[model samples]
Target: MSILLWQIEQHLENHLACRFGHLNYCSLRLLQEKDMVQGLLKLQESEKTCSGCAIGKSHRSSFDKEIAWRASQPLELIHSDTCGPMQSITLGGNRYFLTFIDDHTRMCWVFFLQHKSQAFNIFKRFKNMVELQSGYQIKKLRSDRGGEYTSLEFSKFCEEMGLERQLTIAYSPQQNGVAERKNHTVMEMARTMMHEKKIPLKFWA
Candidate 1:
């Protein structure tokens, strides 16, 4: 049998701290007190400060409540987001829901899915139904750089359709605020309705 050497001292303090999401001083100290990592307390030396933790934990100002631009026509732009792994499953066995909002009309459509992988296919289905009904070709799509939106298949499909993509900055959901707020509003409404009617959460979809 081979034995592993933790070599806690050989590793840099910042690296270890980052591994546990840049844990705070108390957290690190607790680890030492619990002997989770023997000698880990040495890294807490005054000289070994974590810069990443300082930067990452820094607070940013709030986003503007109003959007600077709005689509001039229906389907000019679509804001989409996937929300879930709900606390309870839907009637169709779905635990997730994806939403697409028309930027100009503020119209929102939702689709349920059992897995996140179904998101791309649901987008295609939504595109087909809406384009057929509205007779307006979607010019752009906006979403976070979720794997469902960034997958090779999704990118290729958008390219083939000549659709523009707007991705949010890393860790910034405010860039996709429309979809985020829509989901928030929807959740609040659903919860309020369930409370009023004594409906179960499984009907959230």
Candidate 2:
């Protein structure tokens, strides 16, 4: 037993020297404090150029907070986003879904699609349906500058309808928080319900 324990300690020491020595002292200390890792005491602190560590530690500055825009009436401003190409296709063959949120009412609409190219048509249908029901014109449309939203046909349609287009800055989803958060909420709810019910992946539509 003593011989086996000594061999294990020796192997751990060798592993610490070869694989974990380059880690910062703080990380070594964390490993020592954790119950899952053994032999952290044998690790030696050393200054090493670890590119992965440097990159992992780097982050973009937080975006400045601003007063959120509020709509005076329904259909005044709408936020939209698309999420998907899920790992499993739905029974309806849909692998993508789009969401639209009315700013004033906080009302949400979801549309399923097989391809992203259907986004423009779906938006058109949503606009007509809502406008007809509420008797209010859509004044503004807000979304990320995805290809589906920025397509020539979509742009022309919005222009003809006199709708203001609000596109978030490149790589900045926070600017479209309403739609982004709605998609997150929808996905999380779907995942939770599916998990609890043991629903099959193909029925996710």
Candidate 3:
């Protein structure tokens, strides 16, 4: 026990607020055998209840598993998401913005729509634009299992083109975290830009 006293001293010095106290007979003897003399001495001063220790030692919920996608060229795999029904509607009665993001280039396209139903047509326009410019058909499409993505027209169009529709499991946004996070980031950036520039928030459409 005496030989390991230095190690106990080193450990206790850094985490002073956290100390083991009121050890059972077995634990105390075990510590003694390990030469944890410093910790033993400090334990006398430690309060029975420690807020810092409780907060630091509390268990946290595990994070969901993340999806890994191999990098692809522009128009190869597009992430589509919608953000909307903003509290403050635009003058044009726009309530939402459909976003199309290229997986490889990270370039984004925004289309303002008054209803969620417009997502399908907006996707069509995005497809045409990407195909014309990049000369590549989208080989894969990824989105959450939103009603918009499951629409018959959208599914049929994707099937006919031999495109793989990768819909995340219902209610699991983390599975499509890239697009979900992009929507959040864009909203934050748009808010900051409006605040800094003194532009009307409704123009975010």
lDDT to native, each model: 0.78, 0.78, 0.69
- Please, what is the TM-score per model? 0.68, 0.68, 0.65
Lowest summed lDDT across 10 adjacent residues in model 1 is found at 1-10
Give the alpha carbon lDDT tens digit for every residue of 1-205 in model 2.
9999778866665445335423455656566767447644554443343343344333323434447769999999999999998889998889999999999998899999999999999999999999999999899999999999999999999999999999999999889888887676566546544554567878778
- Per-residue lDDT tens digits for candidate 3, residues 111-157, read 88898988888888888888998788888888987788899999998
TM-score, ranked from best to worst:
2, 1, 3
For model 2, what is the error of residue 3's alpha carbon versus the real structure, in angstroms, after optimal superposition? 59
**What tens digits encode model 1's per-residue C-alpha lDDT throughout 67-177?**
479999999999999988899998889998899999998899988899999999999999999999999999999999989899999999999999999999989888898
Comparison by lDDT, 2 against 3, better one: 2
lDDT of 3 at 83: 82
- Cα error, residue 191 of model 1, in Å, equals 0.7
Error of 3 at 33 (Å): 57
Clash pairs detected, candidate 1: none
After superposing candidate 2, which stretches have Cα over 4 Å from the reference?
1-66
